[model samples]
Target: MGTKGMDQISEKKRGKNKLKSKKKAEDVVDDIAMDDKSDTKHGKNKLKSKKQEAEEHEEQLKRLKETQAEFFEYMKEHDEDLLKFDAAEFEDDADVEAETDLEDNEKQDVDVAKKVNEQKTITAAMVDSWCKLIKEDAKLGAVRSILRAYRTACHYGDDTGDDPSAKFSVMSSSVFNKIMIFVLSEMDGILRKLLRLPATGGMKDTIMELTNTRPWKNYNHLVKSYLGNSLHVLNQMTDQGMISFTLRRLKHSSVFLSAFPSLLRKYIKVALHFWGTGSSSISVVSLLFLRDLCIRLGTDCVDDCIKGMYKAYVLNCQFVNAVKLQHISFLGNCFIELLGTDISASYQHAFVFIRQLAMILREALNTKTKEAFRKVYQWKFIHCLELWTGAVCSYSSQSELRPVAYPLAQIISGVARLVPTARYIPLRLRCVSMLNRIAASTGTFIPVSMLLMDMLDMKELNRPPTGGVGKGVDLRTLLKVSKPAVKTRAFQEACVYSVVEELVEHLTQWSYSVAFFELSSIPTLRLRSFYKSTKAERFRKEMKQLISQIEANSEFVNKKRACVGFQPNEPAAASFLEDEKKAGESPLSQYAMIIRQRAKQRNESLVESDVIVGEDSAVFGKNAPSSDEEEDEADRNEKGAAAFSSSWLPGSDSKEKEAEEEEEKKKPKKRKRKSQAEKKQVEEGAGEDDVVEDFVFSSDEEDDLFDIEGDKDEEDDVDDDAADEIAEPETKKTSKKTKGTYKTWHKNYKKTKNKKKARVA
Candidate 1:
């Protein structure tokens, strides 16, 4: 209560003062030291988290690479052994095993199988759990591992060494589902990052950067250090995921079409690399991606993807196998699938891809390359060509594909025409059917048939000429013409002989019958019917005529070779020339005779119709008679043709006259009515004698002309024989000419004498 109390009372009085309130407010407003500390802690935490993420990504990448190595090593070293493993059991109702065929060849090693199964359990479970982690962090390495595992699982059941179909099929349903999840997560993540972008980053700094192409390209390797590269993880999961992401966001594809088509292209490039490596099993996923692009941006979109795929397979990569051609072919096929139902959505893509695929197939399977790598690549080439065939046939309306279709048809035709491998009979038959399908669909049978005919005519049928030999001729042996390129002329000849036989065998089916084609349904536009359209009719007729021509040509060839075995050695050649009244016999003539016979049977009037006859049509070779006396001589020759001259082409005019008198004695005058004569000729089958005569004429000219008759006085003998025939006509003509000359001379002499007399007078 004294001074202290008075001070306490003052203090109490001071607590009520505005100055004390001001001091309290100052204590409350202490500097934000906690906030600075908290900010520092928060920044440290963020940096730590980023570092952890980066390490995780790097570890995952390393794991993926290791897994890839292990998988390959296992495949190389323990493939067949692994098949001995008992397939892991699923629930009674879960039929994963039913979906896959795992043939266990090592039945004696049950313990080994069980051990392998036990070992796989650990890895499989690890993979299953790892895929779950991948969903949150979304690393490309994890995705790639999943992809490789997926393929390995798929190919587990595959016994065929290089079958690509095995790669697409999954052996483990569990593994496939896991890989699919990983792939979709990663792909969706990338798309979201690519499309949505960071709202507060450098993207907002520049309007051009935001509206134009994504600036993501600027941060390639540097960004990959943090985000990891999709390209490096070339596997099936990435392929499927990328496709699913792009397709699901097709509503946003316009942005890709405009500002980020390269992103789409990059995805395809990565997919192709994986495909080229033969690592990805689901190649159809990549195909769908390309096809979707074509459908969305049109086939013009085909170029970017094609270029990417081409680069992936051929550029700066170690994937130059013949099998890689199939991937390129598949990419090409993807473009041809459908831009739309309309034929107008830019055929440029289809054309470009087709051309690219053709070039790839040709270059990779170049005759030399194919020969060098044939055992390795023939099947691959066959597969690629089959894909090529399918791609070409996909274009039912060939108006847009005309330029492309012909080359494709030629390629298919060449397969059969080229030295066809006997092993390739199945391939050839497939190609033939495909070609027929193309012809039917496009209504381009004429050009296609022409191409096929030309294929037969090529000097090299794909391999070699059989030189007319038929059995076991490796049709492929005939491609190279000479020396260093080919081992020997004999080898080439054998090849050629084989191919010719194959061609004849194949073309024979088409040659004699066009009725099947007439009744067959032609593939055309979806709603358009191919029933008897003008174009369709034309196509059918052309096919029939072409087939007939091929048939005729085959017959000609067979007949030519038919006598090769029994050719009249050197001596008989001479006899064939002189006594052979029907010297120019030919199968061409035989075919003509047959055709004429058929026409006569069908309708006598049609024999005069302008049909597609062979080379010996009357306009081509017939020489009309010079005058009526020659005509009468021909008539006499025809009338007496049945009566042979016993003189048998002896050398002199006296003998010819005696032979003619004898022939006249044997001849009987019997001129039938026109209709009856026509009927008789038809009944006689248009004369096999005519065929023999034509064959004798042509064969002699082609093979034995100079060989046989060089030393013989054949010309003089023929001349003397003709002179004898006209001797009677000649004597009468000469007498008349002499009388006319004498009269003229006498008149001239009289005129001169009279003139002289007059002058004298």
Candidate 2:
């Protein structure tokens, strides 16, 4: 049994060995199959990667070709405009001179010959290398090529279209921006070194004279080309940001502008366009550039600048309303400040413009035609008057602009008298306020109380307000109101309030004078008579408050006058309380401030309410009440009133303004007047808030229509000796006309004027 078991075990072991060998053979086949599959997968991956690499390489080549073609195309288009841009001109000047043996002009021509561009294509790597080279040595000959390329690139798509006016910027804005950044940031320094110009602190006159001499002509030609091209690009640009950026960046080059008169004039013209019409930020930078140019170029180009700015102002202010009023006022103030730079030069411009205004007024009066009246009644005329008035007031202490002030005041006063009726109270008040400004700035007494007092006597003030359609006349833009709305209580209230405000302002301007007691007598009496006689309780209250302030101020001045031991003719007596802080300490001024602050708060509250109502209406639907909607509706209604007024008033082009009104007239009378009560309520509220803000809340001395803030620290360097020469005749007249208090006021005013001029110097 043991032997049988051993034999069986051996057989089983042999069978097991055979099975293991077979299993090992199967495992080897499986390993071979797996290897084959892995090899196949590796081969496919390798083939795919190779194909991708080939495609990428082709793409890079194609991209490089496109870039090269684009650059070559740009060069082809603007090659003529680029100086020293051709390859043939790169020959050594000494070699050309020796080989040609040319004359002086021919050798000079060789000096400015077109330069060779080392790199034919403008690739990324090539640009980088060029930048590196420029950084290392700004005086490299390659810089001219780089600059030419930059100039051509900046205006890449501007002239590509068949119509040169159509701009199709195909190149990305990023590329253009990069070019501008590189050039603007580095070109000034590079140019200064290349032109052998000194640092910016060097005298502009020295630079101007240096640039004009024989040695600097070649450099000046290059600079002029560069600057002219830069200005041309600016002229074509419409983006406010780009214009602002260009002006700001180029401001550093103003010292060089003195050498290029035509370029300076062109730049001034471009800047004036922006200053008058661009966004606020752009306007600021544009004005800064213009100021720099004015300083650098001096008086040679100032007249043209002044005229262009005035024209710009007129053109921009054609459609003045409350929203743009402040901006317009700011522009005017800046314009006056610019004028203060070269007062002697500006005097002629001011005189010319003021004369033009006067001639227009005179023609209007003589012709008595609608077209003539239209010229005087428009926003342009009003803004022009405001502009010159500000110019006068700004330099009131300087005799150079004093002569313009009188005629400007006359034009304004004539405008006030042109339409001597209750309907044109706003225009009349505007004229009076301008007069008041001139009077205050020059410390002279002007008879503006007559204009304000005249409004109180008009039938519009005494009539009870009737129900009116839409927001009662926006007296701001209303030259005339022929609608029954003029008879409304809201209009009456606004009219009376405006009159009272102007009266107080006119009185306040002279409240510090030695003759204040005398000046207050007539105005105070007229105000008292109007105050007691007015029927409206609100108007009466306003009049009473103003009268009380005037009386109190009169008392304060009288007391100060009583304490004055010196004669009224003495200089000390005339200069009493000339300091701003001391002048602001008066009860009248304190009251004015309080009224202005309160008015400001009320205006803020009204604006917030308007905004809230606007938001709610937007959230709702068309039927919902909205402040913006109400304003639009009111605008239409006022337009209708204007159209209606134009019909009855002789010389008005009634057909034009009546277009929108014709549609409204077709509606039922009841519906036409449906919102009369609502409109009246709205107007009453708005009038209560706006009248005070318009009149009492105005912080500046320029115009009641717009509040213009002056820059007290504005540096307008004046020639003191020239100023004295100009003021000599006026000073003699003042000395002759003055006897007691008037003479004292003149002496004090003269002293203050000298100090102010000294500070400016």
Candidate 3:
């Protein structure tokens, strides 16, 4: 049984092995099949690619053959066209040819040479005649062919000594000019027709050649005729939508300007007139041409042209008002150039033009009809004011122009009102300069009161009275106020100081009566404050130096011719009292005493009321009756006895006198309360309580007992405690406070305050 099992197992193993062998053989066969399939697919793709490439090659060959055929056909057509023209048409007639041959042979030639020369001449003349005939055909193609033939004949004539061909030699300027004139005149219609066609290569070459020659000198008349004709052509072209013509004409005119100024000027004038009357499209071109002409001719000639333009527009015809204004503006720019020149000869004319321009501008400004001045000169009004201001300020020696002072000032004030923010420093400077000049002029100072008043009224009308005023006042308002307008307390202080400085300076030279009285009359407190506060240190120094110089040169001051007046009454002792009162001080009895004493020293008459002695006594010391009844009579008798007792002995001060004096000394001083606005400002400042740890005491305040003793002990304690807390935060806060305070104080502080409130809220 075991043997049998072993044999069966071997058989099973063999069966399994056989199956494995069969599977391997089948796998190999499938792999061979896939390889063969892949080969077949690759072969098919190769065949397809070859077929496409062959088709492409064949197509390329076909295109090549077609191109070749087309080229040959074109050549054939051109050759046929060339052959169709008979050579004899270009030749001279038989009689002329025979006479030329005989003359050539008779002069210096062998018979054969002469015959060859005659044949060459005949051929050239034939070419020339053919070209002429072709040009007459009036076709673009025919004309180009004729130009080519003429060029060829001219080229061939360089080597061949042909008598008729000699006509193609370089023509002299005069001869060439004449030929061009004849061609341009007689063949103008034909040329115009040709110009409509696309530009041929030959046409461009010929134009360039003609332009470069000296034909301008000899052919000026013809050139003018051509230019006139060109203008007509340009008009026609413009109608037909040919902008190139206008551009070409402008370019040609630019070149022509250098050679023919006078002619160019005439044409330009005509063009300007046409432009003025013609379409708006022509205006830009005309303006450009005129600008170029003006630039090329320089300023003098430009000025002349401007005058001419003005005459042409304004004086000659009844131009449309719009057009007339346009022309005026066009000429107005020439003033800039005229102002730059040294030629005084043109000044009168220029000034006249400026004045007229101003009138025109004024009229335009005041015009009821808006359309009348819509396109009128916009900048002229500003420039007119500028020019007037400049002129008034520039000629300081010309005092005869003093009459213009008020008018010019009025104009300046008006402009300042009109355009306060105009970006013209020179204009602003001109206004300043004019003021200075007016001040220096030997004329009465024109009170700018009305102008200033107008400005102030305008400001008030613009702004609400409850709101604080604007930061700066206009010059007009400043003039009217006869002082600086104080918008803020700081500004009021500054203005008052400035005014005081001016008044003090004026007072040192002239009398205080002259300076302070006029200044003090103005209603503005700022002006009065300025006059009162400023110390005349510089003025005093100047006066002292002047007095010393006068003493050294005593002869000049003492001379009879020098009209000296009495030394002005020492600034009227009463004036000081008035100033003090204006400064918000009480009227003191001592002020009256000083005044009376000065009057007595000067031996001037004084009124009793003008002097104050105590509260009830008059200056003459006569007893005045008391107005009280019986109690007044008793009190008066007691006071009178006390007064007599005090006067009897110099050292006698009774108990009643001492008591009265003590009561007076003990009386409390009245303090004025700050306004709500001022109180608010102070409270606001205190609310921003940013304490500085490292407090620095000012030198002036260091001597205070509270600051030295109390502050030092408290500061030391705070410093010791703050050492535990980082100092950096306190330092930063203090720095922020300082920077913020400085910026807020220096800038528009009120606006900043409002902003700060908004931010905090």
What are the per-residue Cα lDDT tens digits for candidate 2 across 238-347? 55555666676688776777776667777787888788777766776776677666766678767777888888888877664444566677677667767866999999
Segments of candidate 1 deviating more than 4 angstroms: 1-262, 293-300, 308-346, 349-389, 402-437, 447-761
lDDT of 3 by residue, 466-515 (tens): 21332332221111111112222223322322322332322222121223
* Model 3's TM-score against the true structure: 0.24
Q: lDDT of candidate 2? A: 0.64
Q: Order candidates by lDDT, high to low.
A: 2, 1, 3
lDDT of 1 by residue, 74-129 (tens): 34453445323222222321343333322343443676757655544325466766
Least lDDT summed over 10 consecutive residues: which range in candidate 1?
Answer: 620-629
Residue pairs with backbone overlap in model 3: 90-125, 90-126, 91-126, 452-476, 452-480, 496-530, 500-530, 500-531
Model 1 reaches what TM-score against the true structure? 0.29
Lowest summed lDDT window (length 10), candidate 3: 475-484
User: Residue 244 error for model 1, in Å?
Assistant: 12
**TM agreement with the true structure for every prediction:** 0.29, 0.61, 0.24
